[model samples]
Target: MTEMLAHELRTARAPISAHLFVSGFTYTGMISSWLPDKPDAACTSEETVSHLVERLEHGDFYILCPDNEVTPEIDRKRVAWAAQDIIENRPALSRWHPDFAERFAAFEKPDRNVEKV
Candidate 1:
């Protein structure tokens, strides 16, 4: 069996509260980078979305959406904020953000044990 399988995102609340949507990647630094580096640091997407929702519903989630009402302008801001937050939150993924290279190291430090010699 393959180690990975795909799952669709389902939310109990229709039109997932924008806060929740932003909270996932906002806190977790996308599905890829966040999980491996910080083994003890558990985030929602590291597990099934169902499991994530369970925790979130139980008050485990903490991102606040100051503006919950959706409007065209808000939608634009949401997308922009999420994008900026994603890049800023994870230094490893900062390359994705243009005009912000100085905010992150040019490249991750080489693994300690690797040697050119």
Candidate 2:
């Protein structure tokens, strides 16, 4: 989808107190529609923003709006902050199997001698 469409969807909310039921099973974050009361009802893209705002005001869900458009500067800062967080946390890197450092270290080591018959 285009960036404009995404921005519009993010900004639209209506019904002044409707709950948006994002499917927990969906990993792609694509919603078919926003229901006013029934969770299964399909809502148009235009109706989503207003519906969301309404729900948020009624304490149905917490709304977190972006302060500004995602510019290059903002993107760069986000990446920098994420890198800093990772460095500070120092979480285990074992998940990245066959690590480059580990491979390089093995390659640099001298080969061991084997017994001959």
Candidate 3:
């Protein structure tokens, strides 16, 4: 919705470039409430903003931020799967549904869908 708004604003008003920064789990006050100590999996606020700046400078329209635990490859796969869910008309968040659990697991496996020619 934010992306759509950005697009509409750009179209209706000025020629502005919309850069959406999708952040991952960051070591912030919210996390502090859950965990006393910042986990190794979470990225610092500075790190997260740094990544955003880097991607913004690179002229990325859709920026998917990654934390210590989640790599870029995994992020891409998850995003692709989410898009597919809409395209395929599957259940909302079918990835978490018990019926699709095995399929989601298989989808997460590296090189699972690669075809050998």
For all candidates in order, the CA lDDT equals 0.38, 0.38, 0.83
* Total backbone collisions, model 3: 0
Q: What TM-score would every model get versus the actual structure?
A: 0.23, 0.23, 0.84
Best by TM-score: 3
- Candidate 3 lDDT at 7 equals 86
Question: Per-residue CA lDDT of candidate 3, range 31-116, in tens?
Answer: 89889899999999999999999998987889999999998877888877788789889888888999888888788777755221
Model 1, range 60-104, lDDT digits (tens) per residue?
433332222333343343444446556557433343456555432
Q: Which candidate is the best by lDDT?
A: 3
Q: How much lDDT does candidate 2 score?
A: 0.38
lDDT of 3: 0.83
lDDT tens digits by residue: candidate 2, 1-117 = 334544455578523333333322221225424423433333344454554566566765333222223333333333344454376563344223354345333432334111110
Q: Which stretches of candidate 3 lie over 4 Å from their true place?
A: 12-15, 113-117
Q: Model 3: clashing residue pairs? A: none
Ranking by lDDT: 3, 1, 2
